[model samples]
Target: MDASELLEVLSPEGLRLLDSLPPWRASDDVVSSVAALRRQGHPPERVSAVLTQARLRARAEAKFGEFASRMLFTEAGLEQATRLNVAARHADRYRSAGLTSVADLGCGIGGDALAFAALDLDVLAVDRDEVTAAIASYNLSPWPSSRVRQGDAETADLTDVQGVFLDPARRTSGHSATKRIADPADWSPSLEVAFGYAERLPTGVKLGPGVDRDLLPRDAECQWISVDRDVVEAGVWFGPLARAGVGRSALVISASGAAELTAPADSEDVEVGDLGEWIYEPDGAVIRARLIGDLARSIDARTISRDIAWLSSDERVETPFAQGFRVLETLPLDERTLKRELRSRGIGRLEIKKRGVDVDPATFRKRLSLQGSGSATLVLTRVAGRHTALLCERA
Candidate 1:
């Protein structure tokens, strides 16, 4: 049986055999097998330790010196709760609000709860999984102020908490286990009810980055945060974030730098103008939060098209929220003879992009052999209902 299949069975004999094997000897066999699987086009991420106690050890190693428990490597995929980028952001919010006590509603493996406790904040870390809860307890063992408990979120008793952090279980299916809000009310009690709860104190609800913007409650101030150009989390502030009017801020964080972009709820819009020498692509969260106007004003740029998301600027603006690219050329729509023109220029590998077009990137790439050694960004989009191309280089 494959290692994962055997591990799934949790056989007594298999466990015994694995246990009897020496570490050095076992490592050789496991590494060789994993290499073969990888060569055969299988994802070797968590497959090797499927039937070994080393599975836990492997997880610990992947966590990079951080302790993690109740981490599940199920059919859906390896999901563990620990101090991730988003969790760290939430920890900052809690500290900023001067919250002394916090309730972590769906504390998976005590990642954020531990962060809260590390700050000397009294925290109740709750998880429904027994194995995960045990792991969380061990992970949070160093923190005396944090308590890890096992209970269903719907029925759990939460009281006297100065702030609440809810990252509800987004999995409802097997294997894929994609992000889904199966029951919106399970964690917050309800949309309106959750807002009411937030009105009382600082509440941070961790929603997937893909959540509909229209669903965001108007009463709660929203901040879309991106770490190192990657949109990590969108935080809602009820008590403090609201009072500060940092309403619609884009938090850009990196190892070398950090920036906070705050604008009014209805910031002035930049008028659409001709394409400039450079193009700036804003981070997803920044675009979704409609902070583009603020970014454009800061960079002295204008929109290429009101409908299109691309921003054009003549001056250089260094911000984590947007990637600036220098324009090589802009050509008119010529799909009928497009392949011939690209072939003549020795272009074979094309990275197709679309903003105001209905073309597929994969399909377009396959149809033409964009030959060239250097990297270039090709925009295959419709401007005025006609296909056009914009060859670009890094700015």
Candidate 2:
């Protein structure tokens, strides 16, 4: 939102109007809602501002859950905000460490700050964007111990806080249509300055999961987290916040709860072996943390190929860290032969999984000209050292 829209939305009328609107749905008529409000003599600008928030609140529900109803957000802020469940985990780090205060540098709409304050810790939430800081102050207003201010995160006074959480801006400054900042140096507060905070204070830095591993500090513990199978963020912890004897970790969180695989360092890849009765696909977080070897050992599995993340074992082993599939048969990698084989089995519905292959699944599937009602998963990958296709079923 721009300055004028922000001002309009912060008014009493705006809050009341936003709360009064029915819960937004994809099927709702947005144009009609705006027209109805405008007809009621609400100014066009106020109507637009309130409706925008209403839509944002709907989208925010996936991240903030019910708390999103009362919170304010900008498009960019909502996009980058941490999921409430994940933020609670972050807050637990400080609370578990016996730290009673934290400085959330570059806090975006106070997503993490909300968690910290909810845990009854004092919070200093700082943001360089004035509008975002104002929105954050509003979101964090319910917590008496939480303070929000507009300032440079790098220059923010840290004299009173016991721990620090930094989420540097990895995108250009804007409420919308912002481009990603590729260089860590171009990020707001920069990685160097963000990491430097660990020299004195217990610190946790949230970064994109795809960040270069070489840039990580040797003294810190790096943990990659995946929620519902989607790898979300990589958190680097320092000092007491860093877990003992854990250097690299993969944390997977889903409706089933959380599971973690950790090692003192990246585990050596297990030796490649011939295809087994079961094929397992390790979670993205596991692959990103380079703990695939550890996961394989846990399940008594081995890599299908030297560099491939896919694993296989003759015994059926189940683990949250990976999805196991029972091998159905081996099929020729040639397109025409595979098409004939699939059609013979009446396999019309297919789930295509690929690794260490160049063919696009979507394009390849169309070329097969599938028919019939049966369904199966087609895994196109390297077996031993050669490209192969494995027809499989979820185990």
Candidate 3:
């Protein structure tokens, strides 16, 4: 939204309307609500702005939790902002490193800046977009340690700051339509420039988890982060922020809490062996960090195939880093043979899971016809470089 529209929304009457609204649910009738508001003599602009804010707040709940109600967001800015829980962890690094002040370059909608300021660190939150910067200023107004400015991050004077945190814009500009910029060189304040900041001060930069591994800096501590089962971001920490001796790490955050697997150096390859009684699917963060071998060793398991990531062992093993499944039986890879075997076993419901293969699970599921009451999981993968299927249940 434009500055004027945001101003109207931030006015006293607009805030009251936004505050009075109930938790929006799918059952709410939007057309009727707008009609009711119009009948009450509310201007269309204020109603439009209030409705937009309410909708954005509902969506933002997944990232900011309860704080979303009081925050302002642009469509693109909210999408690009880091989750508040993750931002708090990032803030801890600054506090732990003895860094008292930080330059939050490219700080969009003040997500990280809010966390940093909450920790009592001096934060200079910078964003080039005027509306976003203004919103960030509003969000951070409660903290005396926080400041927001509208300026190019690349040219921002940061001589007084002890460290820098840059979350580069990785997409095309706009609230309605944004194109993902695939090339790291195309990111605002390009990787080449951001990578150089570590030479002068401690630095941390966030990138897409699938960012080219070849582009990672050797001197930084690169970490892949996963929230629940979804891999969300990859970050590189330089200088003291880089955990000592650790070159790569996988950090998993779930409802239970957080767990990490770290490697002082690149993981070594483990020998492949035949499937035993159990199969282990390592977390995505572990796989992205290239630390699957470490996870395999910890579980006393061997790779199911040289080219595949699935690990196998003789007993049930459940660890924080991977999901364990008990092997019920092995199945034929052939479609007709598989159908016959499944039908004989009275399996009607199936959960198809595949790795290291091109077959689409949903498409294959549609082809199966059976009459049974049992539910089963089918693992489609390579074994000894040969295609195979294994039927199993959760361990």
Candidate 4:
């Protein structure tokens, strides 16, 4: 639709007409209302558009839950994504980290903007679309100095902004799945451009959780964040470059219940090993930080290698840095013996985890007739060049 027509449809009177109806549903009532509106001569396209808009509002309302005030909503201050909580939590971190003001690049529907505003930070929320910008402004109206601007970040003025937040549009061609950063280098204004910008200020870039770590800049602080045990988004933190003595690692988790791991700063002299009496699986964030050595020391566990994420210890300790499982017995890679021994021990269902082995856990389980009564996590891994399995239980 043209801008004028779209604006007319979203005009004050139009919004009222849309809002006066009960919230949307797919049931008979909603269907009847749409049918009746059409029967009254409302164009089918307009009716369909209004229904879509109404349903979007209802969905946002549900997503914001009881904390709707913390979100940036549309003209009626409703409509939300279920991921708002995660955004809000990160916003808190931004504030606590001393970022007084922020520029939210690509502020989709303003989910993160609402969180930034909720923390009372001065925000310049920007989007390329006028409709979205208007919606953001309306959603952020409650906070002072929180304004939504329609623009592109590629050439926007950085001025004195202390931190910049970038959520590159992962989808292109009208929300179709596409490369998050078409030019991996230009991934969003190009990583080189982004790092240059970061040199001027602390920059936070949101990337897909599955992004390869090897592709990131050596100097950036990489973090993989998982909320409630489900990995959500991986981020890169870059500011002034640190001195050479400091290590390069990814943070796999947060202090407040996140799982992460780190790659070794120096890759040449690392070691690898099999599962032991105690198995420590680092958090996703920590693994990303490449700070596994720090974690290993903190937990008094030994690293199998700089690249491998698992930690081994004779003592099972409860630490957020890693998920510790008590090892029951160590066996060989022989499936027949492994299966028979597990079955004799009354093993019913098995949760298998493997590293550096080509064995398929599922096919292996079926081959051994592994279906009956017990629950356990079996580690099929190699340590010090030997294929061994460790049966474990949660510590």
Candidate 5:
């Protein structure tokens, strides 16, 4: 949102209107709500601003949960903001290290700063954008220990800060419709500057999960986190904030709970083997953290191919690190043969998964002309240097 929109949203009347509005829903009659508010003597701009906030709050629920209702967000800020649960873990690192003060440089809408403040740490949340900083201030208003300011993160006054959390703006500057910055140097607080903070104090840098691994520091502990099967962020920690004896780690958070796998460094790939009774798909976090080998070994499995992430085992093994599927049979990889085979099996509802294959599951499925009543998973992958299809069931 722009500065004017923000001003309208933050006004007492605007906040009251936002609070009074019913929970936002995709099916809600937005036009009617706008007309009603306009007829109630609310200015068009104020109504629009509050309604935008209501919509943003609805979208923010996935990241912030109930806290989102009371929080403010910009489209870009909400998109880049860390998940509340994940941010709590980041805050815990500082709390565990006995760090009482933290400077959250490039803090977008105070996602991590809220966690820090919630943990009672003295927080200085800074953002270069005035609108984002203002929104962050609003989100963090409940925490007296937290403060928000508009300033360049690269030049933020560290002063007596004990720890630093740097989330460099990875996108072009804007409250909405921003584009990703391809080069790290183009980032608002460049990677170089963000990493520089680690040299001076206990620091944690949050980057995209797909960030270049070669760019990571050898001395820092890099952790990849996935929430509900989606790989979210790669956090690199240095100094006391870095976990002991851990160079790479994957943290999987799901409804079940959080599980972590750590190693001193990337684990060596396991030897390739023939297709076994079961296939295991490692969590995205595990793959991103390059700990797939470790996960495979933990479950007494082996990779199906040299570079593919899929693993196989003779016996069924249950682990949070991976999803296990039982192989029912094998089918020819060719489209016509696969279609014939699937039709024979009466498979209709199909879940397609592939690795090291050129086929797009959606496009391939359409070509199959599926018309059966059964449901099955088709895993198209390379096995011992050959393309193969494994018909599977959830284990």
Candidate 6:
């Protein structure tokens, strides 16, 4: 949103209207809602701003929880902002390292800055966008230890700052709707410059999970983070914030809690064995961090293929790093044989999983003419360099 729209939303009249409105639901009637707000004598700008905040608040709750309600957000800022819970963990590194103040360059909406301040650390939160920096100032108003600025991150003077948190804008340059900028160098402030900062001072750089491993600095601690099974962010830590002797780390965060694994480097030298009684699908974070071998060793499992990430073991493995499923039996990969086998076994519902070999599950499912009452999990992958299918159940 523009500065004018934001100013109106933060106004007393606008806030009262926003607070008075009922909670926003995804299925709410948009036309009726707008009509009702107009009937209350609110101007179109104020009404629109208030309604937008209300709707954004609902969506932001997933990331910021209750704090989202009190915070103002621009659409792009909210979309790009690090989840508050994840930001807290990032803040802890600075606190634990005895760093007193941090400069969060490119701090969209102050998500990480808020966490830092909450943990009793000082913050210099800066953003290049005018309205975003303003919103960040508003969000961080409760903390006297924090300051917000509108400026280019590369030009920020952090001489007095103890630590640095750089989240270069990965979207196209603008205060408007964002589109992903594909080139890593095209990222605002540049990844090259970010790594330069890493080499010079205590720093953390946030990047996409798919960033080329070869591009990662050799000395920094690269971390892959996954929330609810989806790989979300990869952060590289430098200086004291960097974990000792750890070159790579995977952090999995879910409602259950957070679990982490660290190693000096990624490797997949473990033996690939024949398919066993149970199958384990490693979490995306684990795979991305190249810790599947580590996880396999932890669970006493072996890989189904040297190149594949899937793990298998005869005994049950109850680790958060991977999902374990018990195999029922092997199935034919061929269409005619698979269809005949499914019909004979009376399996109507199927959960299809695939890896290594790329036979479309949807098309394969459609071709399977079934006449059965039982439900089954079908795994399609390569075993001993041959296309193989295994029917399994959740362990």
Q: Between candidates 3 and 4, which one is better according to TM-score? A: 3
Which 10 successive residues of model 1 have the least lDDT summed? 68-77
User: Residues 83-163, candidate 3, lDDT per residue (tens digit)?
Assistant: 998999899999999999999999989999999998999999999988889989988989988999899989999978999
Candidates' lDDT values, in order? Answer: 0.65, 0.94, 0.89, 0.66, 0.93, 0.89
How far is 123's C-alpha from truth in model 3 (Å)? Answer: 0.7
Give the candidate number with the greatest TM-score: 5
Q: List TM-scores for all candidates, in order.
A: 0.78, 0.98, 0.96, 0.72, 0.98, 0.95
Give the per-residue Cα lDDT of candidate 2 at 330.
Answer: 91
Superposed by TM-score, candidate 2 places the C-alpha of residue 46 at a distance from the truth, in angstroms, of 1.2
Candidate 1 Cα deviation (angstroms), residue 374: 3.4
Candidate 5 lDDT over 28-146, as tens digits, reads 89899899999999999999999999999999999999999999999989999999999999999999999999999999899999999999999999998899999999999999888
In candidate 6, stretches whose alpha carbon ends up further than 4 angstroms from where it belongs are 174-177, 343-348, 369-374
Residues forming the 10-long window of minimal summed lDDT in candidate 2? 330-339
Better of 4 and 5 by lDDT: 5
Score residue 240 of candidate 2 by CA lDDT.
Answer: 92
TM-score of 2: 0.98
lDDT of 2 by residue, 169-280 (tens): 9999998888999999999989999999999899999999999999999899999999999999999999999999999999999999999999999998998987899999
Q: Model 2: number of clashes?
A: 0
C-alpha lDDT (0 to 100) for residue 332 of candidate 2? 69
Please estimate how well model 3 matches the true structure, expressed as its whole-model Cα lDDT.
0.89
TM-score of 1: 0.78
Clashing residue pair totals per candidate (backbone < 3 A): 8, 0, 0, 44, 0, 1
lDDT score of residue 258 within candidate 6: 93
